[model samples]
Target: MANLVIASNTKAMKKLDKGTKDKVWAFIEKLSADHTASGLHIEPLNAAVDPRVRTGRVDLHFRAILFKIDDKLGDDPTFIYMGTWPHDEANKLAERSRLRVNPINGVLEGIIGELDGEDDRKKRTVVPDPRGELDRAIKSQPKSYLAERFSLADLTERLGLEPDLAERAYAASDEDTLLDIAANAVGWQGSALLDLATGLHIDTIREKHGFTDSPVDDTLDEDEQILKALEQPASKMQFTFVEDDEELRRVIEGGDFAAWRTFLHPEQRKYVEQNHSGAFRLSGGAGTGKTVVAIHRARSLALSDPTARIVLTTYNKTLAADLKAALLTLDPNAVIADRLGEPGIYVGGIDALGNAALNQAGNIADAAENVLGYRGAELTHNRTSADKVWRDVVQSVSSGLDAKLATPGFLENEYVAVILANKVTTLEQYAKVARPGRGVRLSRPQRIAVWKLVEAYRRQSRMDGSLSFPEILALAAEQLRLRAEANQGFFADHVLVDEAQDLHATHWALLRNLVAEGSNDLFIAEDSHQRIYGQPVVLSRFGIKIVGRARRLTLNYRTTAQNLHFAVSILSGAEYKDLEQGEESTDEYRSARLGPNPRLLECDNAADELDKVADKVREWLGAEVDPATIAVLTRGQTDRTQFVRALGERGVDARALDNNPATVGHVQVLTMHRSKGMEFSRVILAGIDDTHVPSAATLRAVPEEERAEALLRERSLLYVAASRARDELVVTWSGKRSELIHSEAGE
Candidate 1:
């Protein structure tokens, strides 16, 4: 008797499982005899269960039944069984049982499982019928639309469901049931159902026509096949989206050149053409492409003289990287590297280059000691010092000195002479300069007395060097004077200084040594309208000859017309009274327009103002604007940090521009001073109120005329800030209105 029983009512035989197995076997024998009696041949038993089945070792017992089925069958034979197991577990067990049967039978059964199942007559089944409900749903859909084709994975993603859930929905018995399950699974709506239906219709059509075979013409390309498919109305379904491969290819190629051209501006191109001289500065408006020019200029110089060493250094390393990328693109053969001493193009920041030079000269440690005394040396050794040591030095120098000595007014006169004369390369040389020069030379007693004064000042101020800022200028000037006396020509062929307006008298004296008499290759680019830092150092004092050599680029390409106009109105004072103004003749900036009218937002408090700014950013994003184009300008780093934190809390992408180098894509949030020469798409000038603007009483400490000039510099900074915006400008403040704004508005 078979241990595995096939019964019509499986649930009813639980109480007499052993007896039922015997009864089932008897029934099978009787059926075989009946068939023989009716003049039909009966095949031998295909399979039967073993009676030695045990609970725990049921898998082993089931193996015998499967073997009988496999050995007795001449060809593939069907078998059925009744069991009490979880549906999934039971299916797995049934598969295992079938595998242990005839190997050929097992293989055929696996193939059948892959096909899902067939009707009672064993014909391959089509996709389940929708029955009444699906038929109604299909009728409601437009004739222009069809069912969609999607994999179970695609359905899972679209529906935001687990993979298993989507798979179960797909395996539903009928179209109506599948739709019902999917609707519940995915929270179906009008558009969602339409999308699903479209996928299904495509799938059904593909299956019905057996469209898996490749077309006969093997020589035809994929694009040609796609075009051929499009030609057939049935193949070109209603919802299919197509792309023109040829047009797409052209567009991709065009974008590369466009990006390249944008990065290399007109000034940059001109600079590249006229690349000569070891030291030349490329200074201009921010987007006027100084960095780009520097890159190509370096490349051109490298090509002209392969052995000529070149260094492309900026105030920012990121900018240096950008410059390096531009150079590589211009000359693919150019050997450039990021590290300082690399054989090719060396790119770094100003300080980095300075440090590199100092390191090579073995003077960086000495220079640090001279500028910052014992504490600096300790900090240098430990590498844990705060970065404001220079600022502290400047402050200490200003505080201990006589008030008259502290004035910048003494720089070009008394200061320039002292700094020019004081260079002690060795300890012996320091003894010679201990005395203040009397007529031509000093007596021993007078020298000792002067040395005592110098030593006292050095101890009190905690300075390593005896020379002050003015003394440095004096010493540098004396170097130039002595060089002329000796008839030795200027060391450099040409001299160019960037941010020329910020240079003080001492700076000028040092720079003078680079271009002595008969040096005509002096090119300086200075925008008097953008000197937003330091004391009022006159450009005229450098001599009008230097000013005459400068060529002006007056086109306001960075900002839109409205922003430019507003900035000009604010800064067009007596100093910049004769300045030429116009738009840049470039296509990039030609059609750019202001998006909104510039406004000044005022609040009763700082925290309230911050909340308002956050709210505004959220509103802008909601209006479909990209977060990258917005910027928030502040007076200091403190404001920047606060604003950044507030914006972050409100889920806005905000970054403090402090210490972060500017890139082409970033929305720069910087001080007005830092924003000099740089431009943006949209600018927000924050804290433009009384306490911040016009500053404090420090302007009074400066001479009245100099103070006026300093105020003009502030106006110039405002001009730069306002003109940075190529599209929209926003000015925000708290408390009293900024005097500069009021003055400009009145004008």
Candidate 2:
């Protein structure tokens, strides 16, 4: 049967009135079920540039324009471009449609071909060829850099542009001009050329576009090639059948434009469906679909092996819950729904795994409320009870007459970031261990003093009969490793971690020991640019090797170019690294769509800022953007509470995000920390000022030497907050704006 594909041009549908849209949906349903139904005249348009352009009647006054898919691939006539056209404009619309594959990214794009007329030429003189201007700019560069190292053939072969255009480009000037014109180039043609010239790997380029090394025979004709392309499961041109009517209706009504997850980009499918021998790491920037890949990979494993046990986890509860909900959606027919929660596939936060192990070992205290001696001292001032212990017990313990020892913050980090993180128990182990990333130095006497502090903290933790979250992870890891050595069975055969950057050092250790190091043992996806908690970890220390098994995804399917650019600017000055300690950069990252520049709202004071934010939100609601697609992000829980209350007072039914996975139907208010791994159509980052962004408490807690690290973490937090926006971003400030905001913005 021929397939029915919906072009990603959602704006075309949005331009119609509701009554017309409903009629259009009815037409599509009938066409998908049976294209030959009476009253549906599906015939080719003679005026179209592409021979495959066709039109189908929706009503006497309205029609649906479509592109015909080749029948040799399948007997069913594959139709795309489900745009409703008025009777008067049906022929004009069909004539404008053209189908072609982007050479750089291998995506099938439905473009409106350029029209030619004397009148049009006259109108175009106002804006000269932006490409010509670019050509002139690069003419000043060294001749060899343009003509010798790179050539016109390279551009033609890389971007899959017209031979005439490539010839014109080559005959014009230097390679620098070609590179300079990249921003002005139409569609993927210009962007891919620029990326190629700038040193992105060919493999990455092919992966981004859904191309594989195994090629279809070159002798195949155009129709045959297209048929082969559609047959491949990962092709962007491939169609997914929406069997469930209610689900189909929900997808259209909800404005979920990206289509179904079953149709994945080839690279994403490669990661999800391909099995690896041991460990694998996938890293990408915000909106790169890392979490989506993790979810699909879990389903893939379960389907491939009926007896397989899989655990899908992340750093926090909210995100894990999100993953579980998404995973459930993979079963469109409810085929595997019954097998999800047991020995088949398990999903939860990584911390829950530690708790489970602790519970199994019977080590955690069930009712030790007063054992730690911190229950009565008001722990709200610090980050956690552990922070208080570090300040009061660890920092206060020192040598000399008046306790004349080094500053205790350094010692505290030494114990946690280095010692306990690496399972260092003895003084000798602490002394000999190399602090590769640590900036502070310590002498023998200082080491003794710090070790003594560490010993005191351990003793107190034992006496309290309670363990911090990190300590639990460490103890669980040790217990699991011991069990593995003694030839014992583990909980899950496969483990997949999403948002791996936020995991603590001991969590990494625990994950490493969760199962024996073998086929499909661990798969982790993370981006250091989204690290809002804990410190960077060296994966080699935990025996997870990613030397040749790592992949970087640079194309962001979510977030617009405008919003993504602004979000990336926040981290441009900061350095980021992967779990394996390799330096990571986002210079090559690009977004799928272009949108309006993010709005920066500056108000007189805190109250004024809140009022302005509410006003803008009201405007968005008036514009008919879904309330569920809007979110308000704040720096801390207090700010979240304030914003939620203020928005509620203004008649906006806003709800603060909590443990529940679903956040639909109401405006969501959440802290930046809680906003990780979530995206929205519109986002408002409120109270992004100097004090609240970095949080005065966070700054005061860090040692002076590690202040830069603290700021970087804050910058990452702001970056994550800003990037969650898909189409629009509004960043507001009250008194002093955050330095994290790009200087060019708000002018």
lDDT of 2 at 566: 91
The residue-level lDDT of candidate 2 at 472 comes to: 60
Question: Per the 3 Å backbone cut-off, how many clashing residue pairs does candidate 1 have?
Answer: 24
Candidates in order, TM-scores: namely: 0.48, 0.77
Which number leads on TM-score?
2
Among these predictions, the greatest lDDT belongs to 2
Candidate 1: segments with Cα more than 4 A from true spot: 1-257, 260-268, 275-292, 311-348, 362-498, 503-524, 535-549, 574-596, 604-608, 661-669, 676-678, 697-705, 742-747
Model 2 gets an lDDT of: 0.69
Residue clash pairs of candidate 2:
1-76, 2-76, 2-77, 105-209
The per-model lDDT (C-alpha) reads 0.42, 0.69
